[model samples]
Target chain A: MNVLVQGVLLGGFYALLACGLSLMFGVMRIINLAHGDIAVIGAYLVWVLVNQTSMPPWLAALLVLPIMWVAGYVMYVLLLERSRRAGQLVPLLTTFGLAIVIENVLLQIFSPDDHSLLSSTGTLATSSISFGGLTISIFGMLTLATAVVVLIGLQFFLSRTTSGRQMRATAEDPDVAELVGINARAVYAKATAIAVAIAGLGGIFLAIRQTFNPSTGPTQLIFAFEAVVIGGFGSPWGTLLGGIVLGVAQVIGAQVNPQYFVLFGHLVFLAVLASPRGGLLSRRGRTV
Target chain B: MIRARGGQLSGGFRVQRWTRLSVVSAAVTVAVIVVLAVVPFLFGADVTEQLTSLLIFVILAVMWNALAGYGGLISVGQQAFIGLGAYGTIFLTQHGIAPYEAMILAGLGAGAVAVPTSLIMLRLRGGQFAIGMWVVAEVFGILVTLDAGLGGGTGISLNGLDVFAPGYRQAYTFWVTLACTTVLLGLVFFLLRRRIGTSLQAVLDDEEAAASLGVNVVRSKRVLFVVAAVGCGIAGALYLANTLFIQTTSVFGVQWTAYMLFMVLVGGLGTFEGPIIGAIIFYLIQAQFGDSGAWYFVGLGATAIAFALFLPHGIWGAVDRRLQLRLLPVGYTLRKLDTPASAGADPAATDT
Candidate 1:
């Protein structure tokens, strides 16, 4: 039960990691293999805020969100606008290139070392509550709560807000949306920005949970990939569910053999693929 | 493999004789093979070894080109077969089989392995398909490391090659590599000239439309995947033959897959000569500047970004447009006669 509870908490964080990746895929149909590498940039942004100012984590995280959002927008204008250019930057090609550049950038700046973000709010991460013999970290709760709130906010933004509907409309029919006077490029840019904004939040969670170095970012992309695949592409709630399952698998695997944590996650990942219907959760719609 | 269907080159005048130009081409190939075969005795042993490795990479790149450019299946995990092929040959040699025999086994073994990987992984489409295959390659790497029979962290070594003389072994490896690369290039060219290759192009252009056209999409793709793996397997065996060793990191080095993909992409994938051209250029670049480490990757990354952003067609694609010459023509085009002789001369003559 304790393992299960802890697993669930860890899953919450994985869900957070996956949401941005899934969202990007949903709207733009871009893999953004550089997604986690971009998150690494966000992590460093918070690192700078925390180290130079020694600011609290939450405050630093909050401060960096707008900046990260802008970075996301710039990335959109520069990278995502040209679909042909986007295609040329296939996962193995351009994303691999981005990984090298970002990792090296972090390495050069941070000197290939691990850095930490001290608690932003007093004991925010350390604080925990006990329930039924399982002690749950408050930051874990924070992560879970953040996921729900942000998801709900995102959902509301997508379904109710004018820009959100424009996003959906553009994703559905970019040419048609352009005909109607909605800027398809801006919609893509906005959706990409929202994805990166969530990634910034994920970066904070990453710093809180583990010691990170420059090269540690790509694995986040891998983990998110597994979650997204399991969740079915473009489904937000499914991404959350996929994250939790991956988290539980990792924890349980480590319990069996600590070295097996990654392998265990991969096993479950393969199992998900081995299933007769891969990405079983995506509600089949008419192909665009 | 170029497989032309339904049309004999309508007899033209002197120009139509291009089909018989194979005599000149095959002569040159034979001459090159003869030189390469004797080169161990002619050139210093060190250069021979380096050239052998280059040949191995060239073959692997060609295989990658076939899979990506011709078949339209972009797999980022091809290193799985490469590592498996290298290991397969090593294991066979450990059991006292000859090196050449081991290479044949490796080709078949690679196809065998691709079967399950394809069944499990080919289901993924688009970017997900590509990434999923890459992770699966990592899984194979991990599995190999855990297996004690394969020497765990310290991988098993190829032993039976000691039966051959050292110079003989190096020379033999070089010849085999050259021969394999030639055969692979030939096979790819032959396929591209066929109906099956056209089906592949159709699939790449539009999967569903190809299906609607009565193409047996899945089987054709799987067969090409298996064939590509076999070619890669041959390259892997030759690689081990040159080095006489294997390790998980060195054998299944993820970077090798990246290297092959870059060769195909930067050289204008789908063009037979493109990968060959890319591999040579890549070798020159790496030999000259690869020691820069992370900076080398940075430069490579920048190059990829530049190409992806600006020159998606690559060097060959550009040259193809400007010159309109195809040494390995995968698609067809209409042409006009240049001479009055074309009106009544040998109909195939106009094809030239």
Candidate 2:
């Protein structure tokens, strides 16, 4: 029971990390292989902000969000925007190559080393609550709470905001969106930026929890991929469930033998692949 | 139809068509090999060794072309089997089999491994197939990396291979690579001409339509998958012979996949002439700026993006379309469709 409880809390962080990725993938149909790397870049940004500005983590993240948004937008314009019209192979290979370049560049600049940020007392990320015998870490709990909150906000934004409806419309059919006078390009740009900003926050939370380096991106990317695959492609709520499953799997595997951490993750991925549809999530949501 | 297209050649190069091109290509390839064969005697040990490296690269590129271009499999994971083949050869030679003999055997073994591996994986289609192959490669890398005797992460050396004396090794490596390339290319042409080739081409054009035509899509794909594994296996053995070792990082390097994709795509996909053209062009790119680090990969990516967008037919694809060149001679040629009737005056003469 304790293991399940602790695992569920940790699963919340995975949900946070995976949501931004799945959202971007959900809307754009682009994998954005640069996703984890971009997140790492955000982590570094938060690191600099904290060290340089004496700002709180939450406030510093607000400062970092626009920068990440621009970075994502620029990356989209220069790399991903036109890629939409290209064949499937084009986006897959180009993004992979871009991932390699970004990771290596980060390595060269940061020296393949790992670092973390110094947070103040009661930051909620590191604090935990103990009720009865099972103890829930505060940061893990906060990340979970934040995930639910942000998801609800995103759901509201998508449902209530005109821009969000435009995004959903473009995602459904780019050609049709053009007929309705919605600029598909602008929609894609905004969605990518939003997804990237979420990724930024997710990365910061991740860095707070673990020791990360440039090489860390691949594993996290794979984890998010598993969530996206298992959750199905387009459902944010499904992604949360998927993240919890992956998180619990890891925790349970660690209980048996820590040596099998990666192997377990891979096994789950293989199972996901073996499913009838391969992707558990549907491409769209509706009664039809 | 054959005569009509053959007649367009006013020069000797086109005079005999198949017979002449075969004779000419064989002559040119042999000439090049023979000259490179004696390079150790002409220049020095170092240059001979470098030439061997280039030949090994050419073999790898051509193998990638078979899987990607001919089969339309587009695997970014040839390194999976390449790494397996290298370690297989290294482990075999450690027990006293001659490296050359083991290299051939290793290729056969890898082909045997490939058929079933591809069967399990063939369920995946398109982007799923592409990423699945990479995932499979990572699995192989991890499993191999856990082996203690194979040196694990530290890797193993070809001190295990005692096939030839040190003095003659590099030159021998060069000849073996050339021979492998020749044989692989020969096998490619043979496969392409078979009924199997037609079926495979049909599948590439449209899977459902091909299946409806009674093409055994599964068998064709499996055979090509196995053959490509054999080709990659031999290339891996050759790479080991040249470098004299198999480090986990080097043998399983993603760079091999990158280079292979770069060569095949940049040169051309789905055409025989493309991979070869790509290898030469890639060699030139490496010679010029390979030492510049990740920028070259970025540039390669940019080039692939440009080709995928505008020139998706690839360099050879472009040249083949624009200039009507079929240097590799894999596909059969018919007379021009617009050509007015000549001696036969048959309307079907213009049919492709």
Candidate 3:
């Protein structure tokens, strides 16, 4: 039961990691192989702010979010926008290339050693609450709460706001949206901005929860991608469910044997692929 | 439509598929092959080893081009088959099979595994397919790590090759590498010349139209996948033969796909001459900068991105367009006579 609870909390972190990926794919039809790397960049930014400037971790996260948003906007405008028109494979390869560049650059700057934001988080990293033979780490609960808030907040913004509707309009049919005077490029830029801001927030949570390195981005990407796929590609809430499923599977697999943990998540993902519905909660069969 | 020429109507016009450039290129290619075949006798062991690596890379690039450039299945996980091939060779050699025979079986083994893998992987489209392949490769990597006999996370070396003299092994491996490159290139060329090649082109251009036109999209993709797997598998076995060592991380690394992508994109995607040119370009680049650590990868990734964005057709494509060169001339091109009547007519009007 404790393992399952811990797994659910872990799922929240995975969901947070995957939401930006899901948003980018939903709005722009880009898989964004660099998503995880960019998230790591966000974490590194926070690390710099906290350690170099001696700022509080929360304050560092707060400052870094806008920077990440602008970075995301620039990344989309400069790199992805051009490749998006080339072909289906071009954007993917472009992002993959970008991922390599980002990872290696990070490696060069930070070296291959691991780093953590735990020290910056003060007692938040060690705090926990006990109830009915179950102890929940305060950081874990905070991550889960943040995930719920972000998901609900995004859902509301998308369904209610004017710019959000415009983003949706652009996603559905770019030409139609253009004909309707929606400024598809602007919508894309904003969508990328929000997606990246969310990823930055997730990165902070990730750094607090675990140690990270330059090379960890690929593994993070694999986990987030598995969550996105298992949750169904486009749906945001489904991503949370998918993350939980993956998290639970890993925990159970660990319970059986530690080596099987990651393998179990992959097996569940493959099983989902083999199913008739394609994903656990996907509405449509085609990915786009 | 018949053209009246010199008071006589001509009903037939010749369609020239082969250009002078193609003929010259073919002659040059044969000459190069002849030279490569005799290289072992002329060069020392180190040079032979380098050439063998080059050949293996060429095989990989060509097969990858055939799969992605032609078949439109941009897989990022071909390393899976490469790893499988190496492990397969290791397993077979551990049982006392000849290393050369084990290499062939490794190719077959990879192809056989690809059959079922394609069934699941082919269900994805475009980017999903690419990521799905990466996942499958990850799964394969993990599975290899779980097997204790396979050295788990660490790796093993081929043991039986010690029976042969080092010089003999080097020469034999070089010959086999050359032969594999020839067979893979020949297979791609053969496929391109047949109707299947045209169908593949049609499918790549537009899947819906090709399916409507009776192209078996799934089956063609499956064939390409299996063929590519076999090629990579063979190359993987040769890689072990050359190094006599295999590790999970090095063999199953994503760096292989990065190199493949860089080569294909820089050379030209979807062109026969492109992979050859790309492989040579990549070999040259690697030779110069491969020892530079992370900077090499940074440069490789930057090059791939630059090519993807600006030079999507690659170097050969740019040259082909500028010079109207058709080195492999697999598609038909109708050339018109200098007569005024044929001057603005449709190029496809000529049929013979």
Candidate 4:
């Protein structure tokens, strides 16, 4: 029972990791191979702020969010926008190049050593609540709450707000959106910014959960990608469900043997791939 | 068939498939291959090792180019095959097969794996296919790591290589690499000359159009995927032979795909000579800055970005445009008639 609960909470974190990826792909039709690296960079930013300025983790994350948003905007304007016109492969390669640069840059700066933000969190790192013969980490509860809040908030924003509707419009058809008086480029940039900011939040949760190094991006990417694929690509709520499925699988695999944890998740992903329906939550036969 | 008259029907012009430049390029290529084949005899172990590595990179770049450049399948999971090949060779040699012979078997083994892998991987398109390939690679990496006989994560070395002297081993490995590079390139060249190559180009240009025009898009893509897997597998075996070591992390690393991408994109895509130029340029760059650690990757990534943005067609594309050069002429160019007499004098050309 405790393992199941823990798995669900862990799923919340995985959902966070995947949300930005889902959002970016939903809006821009880009796979963004650098998505994981950018999240790592966000975590690094939080680490730098908390360590260098002696700020609280939450405070550092708060400050880092808008910065990441701007970073995303700048990345789009400087690199992705230009490559978008070249070909389908160009933008993917551009992001790949950016990932390599970010990871190597992080390695150069951090020296490949694992760093965790848990040190500064003190009680938050250790505190847990017990209920009905099961214990849950307080941080895990907070992560779950954050993920729910973010998902609902994004759902509302996309469905209700003007900018959100614009984003949806652009996502459905960029040229059509432009024809309907929506600035597709602006919508894309805004969507990217939001995606990056959310990824920054995911990064904070990741730092709190485990030790990470520069090279950890690719592993995180695989997990996030699996979660997204399982949930159904480009579906927000589906992403949350996918994360839970992946987390549960990993936890169950861990119960059998620690080595089987990641392997089981991969096996599940492959099974999903082989399924006739495509994915668990895929809406249409064609993916975003 | 001999109709002789006035200006209407005098003679026929012969279509030329081989240009003077192509002949010269072919001769130069053969000369280079001869020199490369004899490198181990002329130089010491270090130079031999470097040349072998270069040849391996060439093989990888060429194979990647064939898949992505011509077939339009931009897979990031080719490292999966590379790892499989290395592990396959290691497995074979452990079973008493000669190391040199095991390399060939390893390639076949990789191709065998690719057959089933393509069934799943080929169902995806565009970016989905790219990420799907990555997932497959991750799966392969984990499975390899889980196997206890393969030494798990710590990896294993090729033990049977010690049967030969160090000099003989180095030379033999170099010769194997040379043969692999020659055969792989020769295969690609021959494929481009065949009708299947034209179909591949058609598929790359537009899958729907090709499908409508009766091109077997699925078969062509599968063939390209298998060929690339075989080439990468052989490269992987050569890599293990040279280093005599195999690790899941190093062999199955995404860095291999990164290098392949950098080489193909920076050199030029969809050109026979592009990957060769790209691989040489990459070797030169790596030789100079490889020891710089992370900075080397940063430089490579930055260069790839710059090329993708500013020089989308790559170095060869620019060179080809400026010099009007085609090292391997797969496309036909109609010769213009310089005189009115020449226009009506070619009845055979009119039929073609």
- Sliding window of 10 residues with minimal summed lDDT for model 3 chain B: B1-10
Candidate 3 structure quality by residue, lDDT tens digits, A1-288:
888998898888889999898888888888888888888998899998889999889889989999999998998899888988887888888998998999999988998999999888889988999999998889888998898899888888888999988988888899999999999988888888988898888888878889999988877788888899999888878899999889989989999999999989989999999899888889974332
Candidate-wise lDDT, in order: 0.76, 0.73, 0.87, 0.86
Pairs that collide in candidate 3 are none
Q: Sort the predicted structures by DockQ, highest score first.
A: 3, 4, 1, 2
DockQ of each: 0.50, 0.33, 0.81, 0.73
- Per residue, candidate 2 scores C-alpha lDDT tens digits across A227-284 of 7666666677877777777777778877887755555656676677776765556554
Q: Which stretches of candidate 2 lie over 4 Å from their true place?
A: A1-6, A118-126, A153-166, A176-182, A275-288, B1-27, B38-43, B94-97, B193-209, B212-219, B294-310, B332-334, B337-352
True contacts kept of each: 0.43, 0.19, 0.74, 0.83
B166-264: candidate 3 lDDT, tens digit per residue = 887899999998998898889888887677777888898899999998999999989899999999999999999999988998899888999999999
| Chain A TM-score of prediction number 1 | 0.94
A44-132, model 1: which lDDT tens digit per residue? Answer: 88888887898777788899899989988987787667643345335445666666677777777787777766444467767889987
- Off-target runs (Cα >4 Å) in candidate 3 are A285-288, B1-14, B343-352
Residue ranges of candidate 4 with Cα displaced over 4 Å: A285-288, B1-17, B334-352
lDDT at A224 for candidate 3? 89
Instruction: List the candidate 1 regions with Cα displacement exceeding 4 Å.
Output: A84-92, A111-128, A286-288, B1-30, B94-100, B154-156, B162-166, B339-352
The residue-level lDDT of candidate 4 at B187 comes to 91
